[model samples]
Target: MGAKDGRKGDPEGFGPIEDQFQAIFDDFFRRPVAGSGRDRRIPMLVSLEEAASGASKVIKATFEAHCTDCKGSGVLLGGPPVFACSVCGGKRHVLQERTLTVKVPAGIDDGQVLRLAGQGDEAPLGGGQRGDLMIEVIVAPHPRLRRAGVDLFVEVRIDAETARRGGRVNVPVLDGERRIVVPAGTVSGAEMRLAGFGAVRLGAEAVPIPAEVTAAPYRSRSVGDHRGDQIVTFVVGESSTDGQDDTSEGRRAARNQGLWRTGVLAVALVAAVIGAFVLGR
Candidate 1:
């Protein structure tokens, strides 16, 4: 019956039924705005060496993409005009996994994020621009090297003989190994600095430096022109007995020696006071 006839048996008119179907179809097949895409986070692990020298890392991520079956229209074809897509529950997107390689800049600190434009989820309806992928860098700890800003600190082991007599110690730098000269009577825990051998300065471009200032030790230079220094701390290792480690024993001995010197100084001060009192009497 026509909608205008208003038959008694007809519950709702054809126009209202069509309008209701259209509303349901519109809700099921809604399209997102252009240039809108899902944002994603990717955790990237990097070694100290990789952070020192820039590297490219690959990461795998899963995101929503426009459905291929429905062609982002959320409607089925080849038969009756189905308002909603049965495969995607009327949603126009499907889950997809992808892997991408990201270039990590040199001198990137831990917890820093790198943004990759248009690498995230694909835009809905296959028309708008894709979203961005954020890469979070996690720098792994080195066995010997500790990072502090752009500076690197490392502890080198030396035998008792080398600690007493002058010797050359091999220190690991970012690029290669550097041999450091140890003066005679060098004590344990002594630190030596090697200029331009540390972490690269991030965000600093290359710039010219003065020759005289470059020669000066402990001069802090800008990011691009100069690099930080590598600080090497000497650790004196004692010979072990019965194939047992002696590091703890050596540290205890060093502490005892300090206490003994302190106790002797205290005794000397007390004796000096007693002597002066007696002389004044």
Candidate 2:
């Protein structure tokens, strides 16, 4: 024989080996590999009350997804010209809009991030894996309340009479109004604690306190799990107006006082007119 026409055990002359190599190469390219796509980060703004109590928010985001027309291959299949896909322009992925509902956990702090897996860009070239979406939580500043860690701080303005007589004063809480006791002889800048009424601790199970349980003592002890206390700073007289106008009752009281003063002035004017007329007679 001039030369061996084929290998000793192969009669088909490398056809099967070529087919096997081609199959392996196709499989390798089709499978998802690392570094296929990029993760995306977005900022989510939420209110302090929503962060404290946890809330569900709808968000609209743009992400890269596999091109449906070309099946993410970047090129048109079964084409004699072998041209790039018109839809994706050979990028293999297209930008698409997605609406997602995000669940913000209770006690989530500002600048914290929430990761959602497989919500970012899809892998290129029809790869299966997808990147993650990072949601950075941005907590808006509260008007009457401030937060430090899990503790909540608020300035409460009380009348001089309530401070002297030791009465119940309404304090602002996350859920609603909470009445806190003002001790006799309480002075301005006095700090009081409402236990188990602050922001929920991270990773701690907590439920919203009932609205009926309004009265919380100044030095109340902690009663539940995964909760921080609300710190109340008292301000007497007209020194501050941080939390005074937050309550409707305060507004109503001010209105009533104004009306009473106006009525007294009218009565005094009428009495003066009558006295002048009687003196003339």
For every model shown, the clashing-pair count is 2, 0
Query: Which lDDT value does model 2 have at 104?
Result: 96
lDDT by residue for model 2 (130-212), tens: 78899999999998889998889998988775566555667788877876566767798998877677888877876665353
| Model 2 misplaced stretches (Cα beyond 4 Å) | 1-36, 73-84, 210-222, 239-281
In the range 186-278, model 1's lDDT, one tens digit per residue, is 677988776666666775532222222232145554533556667878777874111223333444456788999999999999999999999
Per-model TM values vs. the true structure: 0.63, 0.66
Model 1 pairs whose backbones collide: 204-224, 205-224
What's the lDDT for all of these models?
0.66, 0.73
Q: Mark the 10 consecutive residues where model 1 has the least summed lDDT.
A: 207-216
RMSD of 1: 14.5
